[model samples]
Target: MQAFEAFMDDLERVIRSAGDSGRGVLVGGDFNTRSPTWDPAVSNRRGELLERWAASCGVSLHNDGCTATCVRAQGSSVVDLTWSTPSLTPTVQQWRVLTERETLSDHLYITYEIRGPRRVKSGDGGGHARWNWRKFNAECFRESLDTCLAWGPTGEDQTTLAGLAAWVERTMTQACDAAAPRARTKSSNQEPRRLTRDRRAASGPHHDIEAEYRASKRRLRDSIKAAKAKAWEDLVGSVESNPWGIPYKLVLGRLRTASRGLTENLDSETLGRLLTALFPRGEGSVPVSQEDRSWNEG
Candidate 1:
């Protein structure tokens, strides 16, 4: 349609502007169009035109492969999709369509796996070398002594005196050895503070890990609550009993507690396994409950 074409042109302009402003663009919605260019069987002149426009703007369309045929004539189409710029493509590691049975919508829902950027270590560079008296000969030392004497007796004078004493001691030690060679020592002043490098020691690792683990568990609990809310909405649509909802919430809570315990103990493998078991993909499979004997046995 002419209106749809105009709307898409406006959207592309907005996306281009956003990309110019350094924000990665990701657009997803039911565009209500499909084309043979994208899928041989699907036919829509508007979709083909839109796809061309998207390609021109350096956008790639992500199709989840859900079609009306796949849903057994459920009137669902794979028109729901996503498009993103090149910069955002790397962050989207995986994208797939979830099951359609859980919700009232005929079209299958989608999920994306996005990975964050890697962290780099700080404070790795060439620094100033340690100071040594070997670089100064007898004449240089005499000149330094004269310079120190010229300063009036005060805090600055005392500081200069300390430096001169250290220089004399170093030169004497160097002269005492028959085969003494110039060597460099790492300066104590250059070392980073212990607290900065190892923050867990100042704040006990156990306490920090426990606090973070608790926060993570709380977040997971909230996600489970959100899932339950979705389930409740579905139940209301179907006019079904809410008996199973409470058990789902309880299981999610228990899983969160278990995950928190595992993370605090630094058992990453166990935590990963727990997560996989909780979100297992299959037909008629419920989330693993804390009361399950198998979970405890593992």
Candidate 2:
């Protein structure tokens, strides 16, 4: 039992490391545990531990249909399990216990398909190469753009309207690429910053150190405020400049996602009913009745 616990710990560490490195991980084997989380009939210490471990490691069970994966002459149980990283979980398709396959062992075959990441065409200018607006270096972009333009378009590039337009676009893209690298992953900037020293000690450890810590905290707060203000300004400028660009798409997507709670599973008739309930159509404001006026006066 101690050895098994150590093994589970190691497995969790490995899985977490792989996930942090942005690798798709698929682990399938006989875990030899019984938990109601995976199997409907049994819950054991091992199974509970495994469930907790998988949750901490950000792995999800892909055991569909809850079919038993182990069979013996005495009885049958679900010992085999399939686990995948969060990013790979959705790609695990057709997860099922292959009861018919002859494995010549107690554990039945668990099979699933892992769909690979979709490959975007190079010239599509997909999100893979989208400009990183948050980290854009304006001065660098200006310098790079000036250098590119200084080369001057070749005679052939300026011969036609299409050629000139393409040349201009290509130069701008080159400058953008140099100044702002693509962000492959989204990250939050709102997470609280960690103090240089633990706050407990900084609160009353030493007078000078406390003063320094207070100054540091103030600086951090000011920087956070400035960053937020700049980001808001940039968002407003982007929407004003290009109403149909990334900022607009991002906001629209957020609004659509938020609206899902209000709109999900609602047919047109249901939507109309809800709209009418909230806002009854009238030609104009109707005069208040005597009873309503008495209630208001009371």
Candidate 3:
């Protein structure tokens, strides 16, 4: 019993390590011992060790195979049992004992119904299948102007057209004003006066301001490009990870074919409008000011 207990401890350690390695494990065998606490007649010292080991490893000794009395042979009690990690407890939907002859061993064959993680299916749909853009794009000021010019003849119609034209112009001006960058205020009316040659020599020559500005712009552009690339890579990785269990290359082919057919039927301007509506500019606007304070202030 002492030797058996030592062996069970080593076995439990191995099982625990295997389970901790992120893999599902099923460790089942005849340990030739029954819990003395449960059934005094058949229980032994080895049963105590097994129970302790099972508790430490969070293992469940499923009683689907053997009966309590089966520990003593002859009448043939259900002594065979199965054990598994705690994480796999929910997956054990059902357990059954098979015929002894089927297993070719003294113990009956135990079958486990394991429920693994579900696979994603591509057919799952219903979210926005198509997007629209133009609806959210600024109204066409140029188109409005053209419409006003085309309208003619009646004085009443002309007056209405002129009024619309004035409104469109104001809207266009406002849009331009919003898009333009704010002007920097001048620090002083006159530039700092140069000191005498010896005094001025103390300060180094003025830095190449234009060159630095150009370099900074280049760095910003590179950073933007790199960020965009990284974002695209991450998107691709996410799609690959949860692939919906469908061939992506085949889906891409189908999408391309469908797009080709759509290109002929859909107007370029209308498609652009749809895309604009799908991802409208200024959709996530930041507060222009907080308490009328500059953006730099908290």
- Per-model C-alpha RMSD: 33.8, 30.9, 45.0
lDDT of 3 by residue, 195-270 (tens): 3554566545444665677899999999999999998787677666877533465456543453457646889999
Considering TM-score, where higher is better, how would the candidates rank from best to worst? 2, 1, 3
TM per candidate comes to: 0.39, 0.41, 0.35
- Model 2 alpha-carbon drift over 4 Å, by segment: 125-298
Write the candidate numbers in order of decreasing lDDT.
2, 1, 3
**Alpha-carbon lDDT of model 3:** 0.53
**Candidate number with greatest lDDT:** 2
Which regions in candidate 1 have their CA more than 4 angstroms from the true location?
A: 37-40, 64-76, 124-298
Model 1 C-alpha lDDT versus the unseen true structure: 0.58
In model 3, the Cα lDDT at residue 271 comes to 85
Give one digit per residue, the lDDT tens place, for model 1 in 188-249: 33455654666656578687888899999999999999999999787565534664565556
Overall local distance difference test of candidate 2 = 0.71
- Which residue segments of model 3 deviate by more than 4 Å? 36-41, 65-73, 99-105, 120-298
List pairs with backbone clashes in candidate 2: none
Better lDDT candidate (1, 3): 1
